[model samples]
Target: MNAASQSLSHSSLAYRPDVDGLRAVAIISVVLYHAFPFLLPGGFVGVDVFFVISGFLISSIIFKELEVGRFSFADFYRRRIRRIFPALILVLCVCYAIGWFTLMATDFKMLGKHLAGGMGFAQNIVLYREAGYFDTASELKPLLHLWSLGVEEQFYILFPVIAWGVWRWRGALLPVVLGLGVISFVAGVQKLPSNASAAFYVPQYRFWEILAGSLVAYWSVFHPVAVTRLRQCTALREALALLGFVLMGIALFVIHEARSFPGYWALLPVAGASLLIAAGAESRLNRVLLASRLMVWVGLISYPLYLWHWVVITYIRIIGADALTIVSGTVAIVLSVLLAFLTYRFVELPFRRARSSLPKTAILVSLGAMVAAVGMLSFIKSGLPFRPGLADKVKARETYAQYFENSLPEWAYFSRAGIFDAYRMECDFFDLESYRAGHKSEEPRARIDAGCYVPDTATKVMIWGDSHAQQFYYGLRQVLPDSVSILQVASSGCAANFPGRAQDGKAYCDRSNQFALEVIDKEQPAVLVIAQAYGHDSINSFVELARTARRAGVKRVIVVGPVPHYEPFLYQIVIRKHWNDTPRRIKDNLIQTFSELDERLERKYSDGAGGFEYLSAMRHFCNGEGCLIYLGDDRRTGLVTYDYGHLTPPASLDFAEQALGPRVMANLELQ
Candidate 1:
């Protein structure tokens, strides 16, 4: 083996230990941050470290090959494909199989979509549409880490070609790389706050970090600066390198979820990695630090570890595993290491090494096999069965088509775009059919529904809650008699008891809660409906609000639990269409959780106070087997929610009629 030719051996350049140590820093930061966010809020900067390392390493290889006039994009891409595709394909296959057993149809369909995106190296875009990085459901996505891989892959695809073109023209590589870095960096900074999803997922914003590493490679090749001045202060050079690592570590610990990521603050890790790399091969301390056996092993396994850890954590989180204790995290770490080792040994190393030696026909056959397998599995999990007596698959396809044709109402489009004076609240309010129906005339402004149940006397029925409350508006209007009028002011994602909301420069939740209280006191509504999703925030806060309502002469307070989500509705719809699955069988296990919350609320209000009543849809929504999933089974329109969780206008209206309307009328007679 040529010493200089091997990536990590004593090839043309002696192996740099500090770079491996930098990898150690990067991986550790990511592991710690995900495992324990409170301990090191900024540990996510490790991704920045990895980006620099990758850019430097890949650029170095290409530049060295070009210098020797042996550069081949084909060879480079082949290596990348062998290295990336084998393990990735294995993971996706296993994830898909596991999903069939454990995941709901909605979840399975989502996984299939993600698998398709991962295959095409566009998982980042898929994730951006699904949810924010910090969203509650994010941890449940088994392939979430593929977003970074997608970014890196995108960089690799474009970078080498760009470098080759520039080198061919005899252009100054360093200046060009620097210019690109500056532009990308500016874009990243500008997009971080207002468009965090774009900043996080888009390659344009991430190009700078990669450029930073590329610039280092360009400098190392064309203008190698000897460290003559550092002879007298060799110790100081070691100190500086150590400081760089320490600064990265500190930044990892200090950054947090509330803070925007990969903005200017990301410079810390990138600069730290760059400085340590620049500290050179002769520094004894730096060499020893990076060349430590432990560091080298971790670095060696970093890629596979990065891949496996996310899959494990996602499954664990989806199942509501134990919190990240030291033991659990240690177990996770060990499992990650073991999985990475097995994958590298059996899957990655073998495929990568053997690909070149395999016959062309054999290689093509293998590639074809992988593609066929992916297509087959995607179809199967999407409800397409090819077994004996499988006419059901065809029937399933038919059923799904009939379901969509029947359940979707003409008014649903109006609901999504904001029409008919529908009040819109929440970030995903637009995700609703009502919001898409053109109900919103302005951003962040909600329209109050003109009272279909306008009161005769000045009676107020305040709709106070989160997205669940919004879902009930149509239901209430239909069920509620003309004696009680509802003033619907609901916010999405904001529970009635949410202490405050910081977005839109408004405390909408607090304002709504307080407004409900004030309305109760002023108008003395015979009935008050309090409905919201039963997760996050303290429900005890609502106890206080309930207390305040009773003290303010309110006659009745009703707490409504959230509706059961019937699978991830849209995802299932798409997958069913694509894979010949019946949407009717899509079930949401969360129905039990929703029902339980109502039971808990009923227990809380069982005392004969006569003012507090907990209303539940347990009897109406669910059968003994499970909840009614596909809203009247292909003949119902505007019944099932638009998204996985929020209710549609028709369903909401129906629910209001069933639960709140009659109770309000009975109470009003007493008043």
Candidate 2:
């Protein structure tokens, strides 16, 4: 037999270039999934490929040493530190340096927190809680790929103890590993559907893939002769390897991001990797493909490649002008490969080649501690928002701080957009709808301690509709002169001109609209303003509501068009294009229908042909550059619409100055 086949056919845990080829497959799969998800949606299963490799290799080492009665935890860890820390520390420091320049304030703050998690090998824990709706997009997180490393490291730390403690008998360890693997696999399958994030991130749910490898390692060490004889059968070896490849192919094509992952789906990659490993180099498939020179080279540097690939792609996306496309992603991948080669050569090789000594381990540990300290300090200082050179980059984030709370464990957008309570205060009713659920005893909630309507003894403008209308109170109060006092009476739902058929507690909406009419009649406001989130065909209803106001003895009626809106939120735009970039295509993400609606309304009604003033909120806020994401040149004016389409205090004030004030100026005689 050839030397290559001789080395691989034994289960002695000798060097195997074919295994490195497997590493190449794993790393490439993960990179492809991250860089171009559409191309290989299930490529993420490559991480399971890695788990099996780690389990077999590490278990082989531990079992060999324990058999000889010479195993030491110190020796095991010193080796682990040398293997894992060099590339890790290098990647982290580079990320820190580059992140300082490119990342916005909130993004940087999150980067800091992730750095802390990665350093502690608790990235899986960090990631599990980070799957909420309001958090930054997962693609923008540079250290996100580290969760797999964190999982591997945790297993390496814990599994060796289990192996050594259970090594009393010649065959004792197999059942323990097998039983644990069964429990982990079953429990993970049960948990995946309901708590997908936890199943994906948690080690307990993941350890089964590794233990499958341990089972292979156990069989190999105990039955090396039998394994060698099995590999010597060319037809059987070819069949086993072919089946492994087929399973992996099915996994890559069939599984996807939408799948409840790492459940039954995990068996494919695990079984595939195990069969390929057991098939040995003698198989034509293993010898010709996996042991090829190119595959071996990529496998040699796969660890660093995995580390570099995602960060490169993510950083480019964080700052790139347009959305990430295949071309840009290809560029990112090429750069990652180059960086990986450099890291593998300069950073990883030197440390790995050195003798495993206490001082060597100590130096690596110290470097890690220093890097962790930098991460911790950055996190404690809130990503150093005060960093000297970053002010220009950070100003946009600070201007919209309420919309970008990066420090919290979960994100809820617009939670601090500004006084939401004021809109519901004493008028807006949400609890009234829940009476259908038999909460009749639950007192309907409306923050009515504060008067629903703004009090004005003389001429005043009253705004009425729903929370969309009421939110205008802050901005109008701030911008309009004190003489032009305003009234805001609204409900949580749409307000009608008159009552509709009421059921359950839905009567509250009609009552709220009636209350607005009552306030309008009692106060006898000179100008009655109607505002709400307008639907496509609601203009007729609005005109009817306008006629209702006129009948209530209103001197003049102003209809406020819908405010500009954004989807998800506005910060996504900030991550891609800073508001200052000329030709930034801020128009891309804006809901175009609102701007069109505003233009159409202004053209149809500015001539007073509709019998009242129609103030286009979109006209004052939107232009050729698209609806304003934030107001003012430096954007210290804050977000125009704090949430999806409700104006902030500053925006409302701006609206009053730009739209309402001009319409009212001639009549009110305000300079």
Candidate 3:
């Protein structure tokens, strides 16, 4: 150990306003990014910046405390509990209270599960297993930000022990720790492709970011000579500080969610934060740029600001407000600021102070009381905390029994293939482990009607793709004659490219594609009909798949567009239960968003080739301004989808009859 460095203690350390200023920059960028993603595509980098700042500040304090021989795990945990848990618990309480009044049973159920994850400090791992942050369906979960907190807590639990271990060993700990950080960074970079969620969420990959700050802390305390020598050149310090800010600004503007994140690209923000921290209070740029009184003030309340902004934006989106709109975004910020100020004044400051307004016993008791209150609220959400009648009323009643029994499969609703299940879904097709896990197929079933595959007499029409393609079965059965055959096979999560390595599970898709090619070569079927989900974003992949099919001797490939996925899942439940809000006459605002995807797709591939055709139900599904919801004469008997995207059996049948029947018959020359 460095004896001279051991002399420095927590008593000698002072709070750095400049660090708070850095925090202000991070929080504002994240808030702005979430509030208006287009304004700053890289605004999400703010979270990375905050992680670095957290590592630096916390490491500095820990180093100081350990040097003074006063470090205590109990004190550390108590401080953390006091600092983080109360406001989080408060937010959950208020959010659930709102859910009680406004949200439906299914949403409440989801919130309850997420609340449990949040309280347990494993939300990141939970969400990661569920498929990471950018999954379209994930935006609805309110506590998604808690994932970052989970990552931070994981760091907090492990880093102190490592630091203490190194201190006791009296060896080259700094170099050893830096080597560990380097290894983590390399591992993180390598793991980005297949397991992005793990790369994004797990501490192993993120440790380098935190350690970057820890390394700085080590330098400041044990290598003060370095800082002093660097500071002697004011111009160089100013230049480095300016470069740090610019780098952070570039990352916030240039980076995007579509790209893999927190990998090698993350070095920009970490290095930027490190530079600003290294320059410290002495650098003219940091003093003015980061430590400005306004910046310090915002930084002082940044934690609360971060907590409240997401909730505010989420509530706005839930109420059917445009999250990206200027007016709603402004309102969201105003509300977040107001709530943060209130929580900062009423909850954070008092709890953080050594001489709190409440007696220690009273404070601890209040925390217990608060926890009990939240527990009861959570139980209420689990199904009516104390009300037996309400519990029975809110339960998943038998009204949807027909939908469950005939309309939705247990596999459709709750299997790993189902929406609710999240296990064993991403295996490689050719891997023995994956084939055992069902990514591979044992055999290919012929998708022909009445076991007919006779030439000239029998023309088989095959359907291929994901669940979206699976949805076409109901529609196709209605249009095709009893004389001709129809074949359909789909698996969830498989893209058009069949895995050559893991061959078992993809047999369905491969056979369907192969069947179309064989029919073309054999000239048994008149038409080769194929359709898939195509959007502007998917145009390149869609074109490539279609080109491959065409080359395989398929006469034509069709592209189907995506359906609009709603935010709060209950909107459909309410519409189905009470009123008719069919896609034909959807709200104008929603139509605009739904149409955006279609318009972009149509523009890209409208003129591809004879190899491609666009089969659109847009005219039937939507009018010029909006789309229909259900397609029946009466409100009580219309057929649509049980959920937002998948079609109901009857509705799917009708859609097939209307859209693909003529094409299929013509393709087969069976009319």
Candidate 4:
């Protein structure tokens, strides 16, 4: 055997039951967080723990071979394939199969995109582009958890090459690795406040956690006696291990998604995991707790468990089931555990242990071809839209024709330009220069136009606020005469109030709203219309906006009240409750329940002290029976809103005619 092979021989490395136990802890924390976030709010820190463990173990093996000149990149890659591919591919295939039946065309298309990203080990980048970690939309994505795996895979790709180069140069591994970790940690912290999604998903910001483990591995290999001496100091080792446990416990119990993460806060879990690994199995805490048989067994199946849990939970959420309830969550947990065990036993073990008829290179090539084929098929076929029996109930409905006519392909509909198209502001708002510039700014400036509705005429009316304000534009155009010129200065998620963080925690909304107010002053349109989603805090801000508009020589200030909002997205509600049925009136009680916030806002605005006119959207949409989410018997008249709160173009037109047409015409002297 070569010296490198001798150093990496199985006898040279002892099995660490404590590491397996640590794996158990990490997997359990993640599973619980997915199933019941409230139960262990900081359980997501487990991914950080996993990152450290992976860095430690993988680096230890690589460093061993490097020290003795036995490291083969090809061999290392083959081992990675054997370890990661079996369970991951199996899970991906299963998720795709389930998604085929449960998801809508748009959702299925996203599934295809995510599947491709997962197969390519680029899910983190894909998800970063899609939405933030805590976005409601993210809950519906089955492959969202694969982002962490993507980060790890990316790390491994670069780590081995860099480490080998350092070893080849005969440089000290410890200081170089430690310096890299510190740099990564600092970069992550610096970026966390500005580009949180990048900080969370990008490998550079996350490498430190993994490198912390690599540092431990370096010490283990280079200073075995020192490690032994430290482990032998029973009192010191136990104290350190206990302290580490406390830090991790605090992370599991106290950390939450609301806080900026994987930055400075990540140190708690990463350090705790490193301390436990450094203490070794000899420590009382490691021996009694982490190295127990139960933990070891859990650790053994942790990979499959992690793979199975999120998809199940996400599917539950997709189907509109109560994913958080104890009963349903328990069922999901049980199902995940069962599926995990089967996958581990049948898929993982067999593929890992069985000798292949083909060479490792050929086997890897075949696997890569299979993965590529699956991804391509999913993407090109648009997740097999013609899948038999899928959406049969939806297709059977009379509204299906209209739904099909309006529904663009998922990818086309969600493109940056496409989403803005829903508001009919794509041409004006998404100019290439503006779009690129917006990304660089903390508060993206809104693109205001004098002639959205009538380019020939001067600006007669100004519309302001967030997306809610933008939804009224189509309606305003439809109801107003040709002579009326309207200018819309609205930003998504920005409310017309004093500058403050928006609900999405973006400062752009406030900055844009303030800028829009300045434009209204400069333009001095005949009428100023203000609309926003209802929030108690925004009431004062709306009042301020109205006063500012009136002071700016605006003839009128019309404050459009909040519309009824649904729990899940309106489209999801339609798909679940009404997709198979003929057009039916929405129930009054249901409308009342959904519009509870609107009603509260209405009451608050009833006082109307600011000399601003308050108009309730419920007045036009709701009747004695309920609200009109869809109009006409065939449900072809209008879709009230495409999503939970944003109006479709046709619905906006209808709303303009019914709610604001007469009021706006009177104010403009056009009727």
Candidate 5:
């Protein structure tokens, strides 16, 4: 081989111990973050470190082959398959098996969806559509970590194609790659504010991290002498390497999920990883610290280690237990390590090294088909509800039919179903399409037409607040006499008290409340009823709303207090109760935890209200015996709450008629 070819061969064939050590750092950080997040808040940045390392290593090999006129796309992909597929497929299959026994139908169905995404290398897209990165729901998803793998695989597929194309036009490669990186980084920063989940997971935003590594590869190839000279500068090399380590430390310690990420904040770790890679093994930090035998050992099994850790942690969480105790967490970590080693030794090594009768392409295609088939089957069967008697358990529950009877259609429950039938006749249901398209402020109000629900001469009762107010409408419609008509001016999550104040940086609530206020001013209804789910500022908002109503010429104002809530979904608790025979006292404790807030809000608002009247829903649903989750002795006939807090349609009607109807009527002098 020529000198350049010899150098390339040495670099590609000879493993850099320090690189493995870096892998150790990345994997450890990620595993720790998953197992004990409080210990290392920014451990998620480890994924970024791996991305950079992948970019550097893969690009170096591809660039070296291109320089020698021996680059083969088939060979590149073959190596990728051997390296990535074995451990991944094994872990996925194991996860499917565990999930079958442990997860609920809804959770299993979601797992099936993720399985399909994992097989297709589209897990990131699937997760992005489902929930945000910081969502509590994400912690329960075993396959969520595969999103990083998906991103890396996407990079592998695209980068080689781009690099090969650029190689043909050698002079343009640098400029094109650098320009794309800059554009991608800029786009990620801009998108973080508006669509953080998309910005975090989408390939376009993440491509820059991989490209940063590719740049180092290009530099190493074209300017070998400069790289050599830089390595010779021991002081500079040590400073750079140490500085990179510090940056990584900052990412692993200071950053958190709450921070806007993969934006400027991402640079800290990405740049650190790039600098460490560029510094070479001769540097003091790399030689003494990163290149240690222990670090290299961990690095060797990092891929499989990462694959096993999350599923173990997620399974523990899925069991509905508290966070893992230190001993339990340690055991989980040990188990993951042991499994990773076994998988690496028996599964990963054999597939990678052994020659078979089938061609590599055929083997890959067959494996892909098997994965797809399994995922499709799981999805089609709705996660095979027959497993562990889930179907039987659900069927045996008395409230099974009752649950569906009062359940709103999916769109309506989600607050996307638009206005009620009463308002639909007056104006198009708040123009949902227009509102979604940024024309929210221009969307017309949902008004109740005169003589729609009552006679033209009847008194008008207008209800306003957030979704809690919307929930009251169902009950009010059932109990209100023919002499009164109801007009609902409510939007999901829109607090009536502070229409203009933004929540979570979204202005949809503000605009919706503004429109509701305008409707109240124009209509001048006889009674304005305000209700909201209790939140931090809810009490203050309730007082302010009452004042605003009196000023707007609404004679009577009624403030409805919040209902009971539970930590987990009430349905999940009910399901658990079926299997565990949970004590009534235990159930009461869970109910009390959520009810305390409701009780406090009621006491403060009802006792000291000035002009308007305050009514408590707790009186009907909760008492000394603990809040009613289900009604009727059969335990299946009536469900008081649809979710943890929201009332079912029947329950809403019952509460309004039995608890609220008399009080509201008396206040309006209609009794």
Candidate 6:
């Protein structure tokens, strides 16, 4: 036992402006990363920075109180309420109020669920399961950033009690906390390969980062003499602080969304934060750079700044891509900073300073309860579906359904295969899961049409890929003659890959893709058409998959180019932005984001690689004016796509007849 160290209690500690300065660094990184990921691809690590900071500060307070024999769970939680609730309640209410008008039933429902997650400090768990394909839901959910808070609060719920128990047995707290942190780190590494999203979000996989700071707090508090001696060395202090910055700099520049994060990559930010904190106020760089007036001011508001920026940018994106200009983004950031300052000054300060006849804790708890009530109401009421101006929108949706039912005959491939019901929501956002629990409930029982194989008078045309491929079944039926048999096979989350490992529960994708290849060899279908979600996987991977199909003795392999994708869904876009009584044409700014990629694919593979063809599905759906937004004669009749990128039945038929049919039939007259 370090008996001498126990004498130095919480009374020895003083506020460090450099800590706030470090906070400024973390919050700025996160805000910029969310708004402009490219500029700071690894900026998400800022949250880890916050995690370490929270652990150190929270642990120090608990240890200090425990040493003084004044530690109370009630007091600890009340302090937390004062620290966290004011800004959180305000943000939740604002998002709820705005969403009442802007969000549809489903989106509003998601918002409610997310809001509940936020209020309960379980946002991480909620978001972990709520992920969509490519993890693209981040930009959509306003309170997604609250996931960090969830991890922090969850830690506090467990940590203080554990610390109190361990503190009674002298010197046991450090070993116990350190042992738990090591276990968490090992678990995170194990989970990363099998499921990166799980590693990123789950509390068990994430606690090590917080514990790293907790360890630092323990070291600083209990070994005050040793720490002071170490930091007193001017050269050593500067070098350690600079090394911390270097590690964080590497994380900010080198790591990106493509990287499996919160794995080994997370260590950089955690270590960096630990080093900066351990370096303490005496380090010259920490004093000069981190503790500067501006840095401290920003750090003071970092909490609210973090809360405001995402909601601001997310609402901007929800409005439509046109409004999400660089100028708009800059404005959003500026506005967030302004709001953050006001919140810090008025909302947060009052709560922190106020003493009430009723305890401040009670007021904060009540506010949180009210916010939870709002979220619950939104969820239970299905986003208040009776909001005005939705009659025509509902009618248009109904009309689209009727159009699909009436256009049924050309769906022979799906009818004979009977694969429609199972793979119906592939490439869809609402139905997507990170590692969908229901998918692994059973192995995929794919129903392939016998005509897809068994060579006869019919020349078989097989469509292979994900849901995007299944969508073609509708179009091919309309354009191609009766003699030309179309075979469609697809799986959600498979997205046309060289068969390999997928997220947990998605092992079926590899088997299905391999089955597709085996079918190619066995059936020797005249055409192997690969259609997948747009702007996913690499061009090399797609080209390699096509090459592999050609080697399988498929006479021709047509690699379909990226489709025109829409953000926030085409229907929502129309309902929110273009839902006027008059007919309106929709241009796809989202597709144009991928226009360069589509163009590059066509240019590289257009000339044909061993009877291989590259068909631009995008071109058929777009023109000089813009991408197709409506499938029928007018916008009122039917929109082009139901969700973000999945084609409506009419658009599928239109795209097939106009683009794919002519391309496929050009070289072969098998009939």
Backbone clashes, each candidate: 35, 3, 28, 1, 2, 0
Against the true structure, candidate 6 has what lDDT?
0.73
**Residues 1-671 of candidate 5: C-alpha lDDT, one tens digit per residue:** 00011111234544678888888898899888888889999999998988888777788888888899988999887767766777777888899888876666556766887888887788887766554211225655788888887887888788888889988799888898899889989999987765576688888899899889889888887788999899899888888899899999999998998788979999999999989989998898998988999988888788888889998987875565335668878888999999989997898768766888778666766787698678878776665655564555554442342232221112222342223442222322234444333233322344434432332444778877666777777677778887777776665555575554634333455556676677677676777877776563432466676778778877788777777765445555566543446323234325463366656766676654556676777767777766676655534435565555766666777888887777667667842
Q: Say which candidate scores most in TM-score.
A: 6
How would you encode candidate 3's per-residue C-alpha lDDT over 1-671 as one tens digit per residue? 00011111235466677888888888888898888888888888888877877777677878878778888887666666666766777777787676665444444545665676666667777666555111325545677787778778888888888777787764666876799789989999887754566788777898788788888888887788988888778888888888898888889888898767888789888899888888878788778878898988878778778877887787667545233489989888888988978887788767655574655544653664565455446534442323333344334332232222211112223232232211111211112223333233233443433222333345555555545665665567567777656544334433344344112234444554444344444542334444444332342366665666666555556666665443333233333332323344554334345467666667666765434666655544666564555566743235354444555555666766766776566555633
RMSD of each: 8.6, 10.8, 6.7, 5.2, 6.1, 5.8
* Winner by TM-score between candidate 4 and candidate 2: 4
Model 2 Cα lDDT, one tens digit per residue, 1-671:
00011112224458888888888888889889888888998899988888888888888878888888888999888777767778888889999989887666566778888888887888887887665322455766899988987788788889988888888865778889999999999999987755566688888999998888888888887788999999889889999999998898888889997666889988998999999998987777778898999998988878888888988888886666344578898898899999989987887777656666558888888999888888888877766655666666466555455345534532223335445543544455545333223232123355443455656556677877766677777656666678776766666545445654222224566566667778777777777777767552252365676677778777788778877776534655654456555342257656677878877878887777777778777767767766666665544336565445666677777777767766765545532
The TM-score values for the models, in the order shown, are 0.66, 0.69, 0.81, 0.84, 0.80, 0.87
Residue pairs of candidate 2 with colliding backbone atoms: 426-447, 426-448, 475-653
lDDT over C-alpha atoms for residue 584 of model 3: 42
Candidate achieving higher lDDT, 1 or 4: 4
Model 2 C-alpha lDDT versus the unseen true structure = 0.72
lDDT against the true structure, per candidate, is 0.61, 0.72, 0.61, 0.72, 0.70, 0.73
Identify the leading candidate in terms of lDDT: 6
- Candidate 6, residues 1-671, lDDT tens digits: the string is 00011111235367888888988899889888877777899999998998888888888888777878899999778667777888888988998887776665666766887898899998988877655453334666878888888888889899988998888796788889999999999999987865666788889999999899899999887889999999999889999999999999999999998777888999999999999999999898799999999998988888888888989898888766344667887888999999999998899878666777877778778889878887878776655555565565655543332232211113322343343542444422222332444222213444444544444445778888777777777778778887777665566656666556443434566666667777777777788888777444462266676677767766777778777777766665665566654234566446566677788777777688534788887777777777777765656345666556767667777877888888789745643
Tens-digit lDDT string for candidate 4 (218-247)? 999878999999989989899889988998
Report the poorest 10 consecutive residues by lDDT, candidate 6.
1-10
Q: Tell me the spans in candidate 1 whose CA falls farther than 4 Å from its real position.
A: 1-14, 35-40, 66-70, 132-136, 168-172, 226-236, 281-285, 319-329, 352-356, 359-480, 489-671
- Give lDDT: candidate 1, residue 94: 73
TM-score of 2: 0.69
Q: Which portions of model 3 miss their true places by more than 4 Å? A: 1-12, 132-136, 321-324, 354-458, 482-489, 498-543, 564-584, 589-597, 600-610, 633-639, 642-644
Give the least accurate 10-residue stretch of model 5, judged by summed lDDT: 1-10
